[model samples]
Target: MKKIKGIIDRFEEGFAVIEIQGGTKDCPKDIFPKDTQVGDVVYITGNQVEIDKSETKKLAKEIEDLMNEVWED
Candidate 1:
């Protein structure tokens, strides 16, 4: 069981493409939870996927900080 975190980038052909820290992947709609949408954070392990609110916040903060650094220089 490999666990990873990612944000739902978009959906195509009934598959949801999740953007992770270093890559992206397409998850079948059947395995995705209802009410999930773009920008939602998710935790994936094997065939199951679910939301991780804390990890979402953490990733958002990291992105914000990176953007801040780029503009501050």
Candidate 2:
């Protein structure tokens, strides 16, 4: 099985837009966990999708730091 790491970019209609390596892919929302949200990190292995909470938090923190730095006077 091929394992891919991606981020939940957005949701449109009944599909979730996942940003993976190189580009993005549209996957059915039902394949993701019920509590999954935009910006959450995910791992896709074959037909199963799993959220990576720690990685999500880490990425969020990194982005927040960058934004803070950019906005600081």
Candidate 3:
């Protein structure tokens, strides 16, 4: 397993585009937390950081709802 730091770019269906220190890759949004955002920094592990579809969907929805509420003001 490898650990790399990256910033969340956007949610695409069930994946998240994370801009890593050296390259950009797709990771499951659920791997982090529900509060993750476009600019939030994250650490990823494993050979490939892909996340499960069902979990990704659930977390993405939660993140979307949180963003909406946070930006409502």
Candidate 4:
């Protein structure tokens, strides 16, 4: 099956809220890495989810920066 691109909008009750090009879906949160978070882009096909490594790294850094900002003195 063709993989569809999506972004994680949120996670609730162990489900990942994915926002696709034209819609949204709730997938098993465990289908992704433990470090996955909202705004991380991913590719999905059936029950398989493949995260975009570059985008994930970007998001991770963005989150780290945001957290640092929150703790800045």
Q: Write the per-residue lDDT of candidate 1 for residues 1-73, one digit (tens) a residue.
A: 8898889999999899999886988889778888877878998898899987777778788999999999995
Clash number for each model: 0, 0, 0, 0
RMSD to the true structure for each prediction, in A, is: 2.7, 0.7, 8.8, 4.3
Tens-digit lDDT track of model 3 for 1-34 = 6777666788998788987766789876566666
Once superposed on the true structure, which residue ranges of model 4 sit more than 4 Å away at CA? 56-73
Instruction: Provide the lowest-lDDT 10-residue window in model 3.
Output: 47-56
Question: Which segments of model 1 are wrong by more than 4 Å?
Answer: 57-73
Ranking by TM-score: 2, 1, 4, 3
lDDT of 3: 0.69
Residue-level lDDT tens digits of model 2 in 1-73: 9899999999999999999886999999989999999999999998799999999999999999999999999
Could you tell me which 10 consecutive residues in candidate 2 have the lowest summed lDDT? 20-29
The model with the greatest TM-score is 2
User: How many collisions between residues are there in candidate 2?
Assistant: 0
lDDT (10s digit) by residue, model 4, range 1-73: 9988888999999899999876889899888878776888899888788779898788779989999999999
Deviation from native of the Cα of residue 45 in model 3, angstroms: 1.8
Query: Using Cα atoms with residue i matched to residue i, what is each candidate's TM-score against the true structure?
Result: 0.70, 0.96, 0.55, 0.67
In candidate 3, position 61 carries an lDDT of: 82
Colliding residue pairs in candidate 1: none
TM-score of candidate 3 against the unseen true structure: 0.55
